[model samples]
Structure formats: structure tokens, C-alpha cells
Target: MSPYLLIQLAALGLYLFLVAVNWSALPEPMAVHFDASGDPNGFMSQAWGAVGIPLMVWAMFFGLTVLGRDPGFFARMKRFSPSGWRAWAEFNTLMGLGLLTVSSMTVLYNVEAIPGEWIGYSVWIFLAFAFLAIYRLASVGR
Candidate 1:
């Protein structure tokens, strides 16, 4: 596996580990949504709140990996630039990690393990990663 793929797997593993380790301690109704100021404004079933986000994150990256394997998936991009699948992997890894960070923070926040305000910080971090991913994607095939 490329280092980028490994990093993506690591992110998936970390997200799962966090959810599993904290599952029992989480409230039945978790505070899953927060406002601009980081206060919880919405709630959900603990199972879904804890598991849904991470699963979605992993699934999205996994889909990207699968798409990369399709015969014609990278052909067009490869024609324009040789980086090909590696570039996709890099983008996938970053977006996955950024999402994982935010998801993990929300899970932790629900347990009162983290301050309410840190969710915003995690969101900011995700946005930074997102912008970097955009630049990387746009630069591909250049």
C-alpha cells in the first residue's frame, strides 16, 4: 500500500477505536449537533451518533479507493499527468482525517470529555484540510 493509503487506513482505524472505546460511556441520547458557538443544539440516538459519522467517513474513502481501481478511473487524468492514483489517495487521506478529527471531537464532546468550544476548532481544522485538498485536486493533471 502507498503511505497515503496507509494513512487513510490509520484514520479509519482511529475513528473506530475512539467510538468503540467510548461507546459504553456515552449517553443514550447523545448531543450530536453543535451551533456556531459550539453549544449542542441537537441530539440523537447514541448508537447512531457515535457510529454513523465514522462509518460514513470510512465508506467515502473506501469508495474512492474502489473507484481508483476501476480500469478507466484514472486513465483520463493519467493522460494529462502521471501522478494518477497517488494524487487521489492523497486527497482521500486528507479529507478522511479532517472529517475524522471533527467526528471524534463531537463524540468526545458529547461525553463531556472535551470542552464544548473545541468542536469549532475541529471544524476549523477540517476546513483547512478541505482547502488544501481542493488545491491538491485542482493542481492534479496540471
Candidate 2:
């Protein structure tokens, strides 16, 4: 399996685990309220987790597995093409940036809806910076 895919699977599993943990902590009334409202707060919290933790893990693995390795390391290790990786990078970068912008605006507009709006803002800003750093690195190479 591709490292990226593995990272995603691990992320999803972790996300589910987090939800399970958090869900268990809530009272029945709040849980029902969350379900009724589609749990926007929970959704945002999970999203932040899914994006933040797993991406860091994947970056570490990518650095170790791909960087300073053999020239055809990716080609031999995975079936994904360079073009496909490029597309994936672009898509994720845009999504990361979008999430950052949206989360910031959400914090600014509805600070009472969710806890830790300041943390969310900071996390989103980090994600935005990470994406921009990756984009800049990619562009310099190209």
C-alpha cells in the first residue's frame, strides 16, 4: 500500500477512536442534541485531529522513507505515479488552506459555538503555513 494511503487509514482509525472516546464522554441529552444538530462542534474537532495528527505522522514517514533514499524509491515501493502525487498534493494543499481560512472565519464570527476558538485559529494557521511551505518548496523544484 502507498504510504499516503496507510497514513489515511491510520488517520481514519484514530479519528474513529477519538469520536468513540468523546462520544462516550457526553451525556445522552447532549449526544442527542449533537446528533440533531449534526454535531458541528464534534465535526470540527475531529477534522482538526484527522488533518493535524496524521499529516504530521505522514510527513515524518515520508521524510524517512522517501527523502535521501534511492532515486526510484517511490516508483518501486508504490504504484502511484508522480503526476498522481502532484494532483494529490495540490488537492490537499488547497483543502488545507481552505480549512484554515474557513476555520479562522468561523472563530471570528461564532466564537461561542465551539470551545477553543483561539486554538482552532492557531491550528488552522499552522495548517495554512504548512501548505504554503510545501507549495513553495514544490515550486522551487519545478
Candidate 3:
């Protein structure tokens, strides 16, 4: 298995574990969205709050895994050539992991599992690292 896949799987597992451990403690309607100040600005039922974002994250992971395995898929998309598909997949996986980390932290914050001004800072850091990773991947096989 690819190391990227392993990391993504680990992140998914950790996210599921966190949700399982904190599910019951989450309020009926949990804060699913936050404003610039890190204050809750939107809400959703506990079911959605706990599962929705993770589901989306999992979908991205699955899709990217499929795309990575089949570089030919990129040939149909004018934006990318088959030669660059693997690197694109690598970049996607990196971003996906970053997103998973941010989502997990957001969930934890909403459930009050961990506290502080984390969401904002974490996002900035993730974006910076993601861009750097993508740049490095773009230079691969050149």
C-alpha cells in the first residue's frame, strides 16, 4: 500500500475513534460552523454534526485513491496529463490528510473535547503546508 493511503486511513480511523468517544457528550444540536472569531455561527443535529463532515472526507479519500490507481483517468481531463496524474494524486492525498486533521480538530472543538483558538490557526498552517507539498509534488518526474 502507498504511504499516502496508509496515512489517510490512519487519519480516518482516528477521526472515527474521536467521534465514537465523544458522540454521547455532544449536544443535541452541535456547532458545525464557526465565524472568523472562532465562535459558533451555525449548527446541525448531532447526527449530522458527528458524521457528515467525516463522510465527505472519506468520500474524497476514496475518490482520490481511485484516481491515483488509474492515471488514465486524468487523460480525459484537459487540465492534467496522464504523466502528471500520480503527482496530482499525491498532492490530493496530502491535502485530504490536512483537511481530515482540520475537520477532526473542528469536531473536537465543537464537542468541547479540546479548547482554544485552534480552527483558524490550524487552517492557515494546513494551507501553507499543503501548498508547499503540492509544489514539491509538481516538480516530481520532471
Best by lDDT: 1
lDDT by residue for model 3 (72-140), tens: 765665556544665666777777777777777777897787663687777788899888877876666
Candidate 2 C-alpha lDDT tens digits along 1-142: 5544455445445544544545434332221112222233443343344345445544554444334234464556354456545545444444444443443333332333344444445555667776775665455424
Residue-pair clashes per candidate, as listed?
Answer: 0, 0, 0
Alpha-carbon lDDT, every model: 0.79, 0.44, 0.74
Give, for candidate 2, the lowest lDDT window spanning 10 residues: 28-37
Worst 10 residues of 1 by lDDT: 76-85
What are the models' TM-scores?
0.87, 0.38, 0.81
lDDT of 3: 0.74
**What TM-score quantifies how close candidate 3 is to the native fold?**
0.81
* Candidate 3 colliding pairs, count: 0
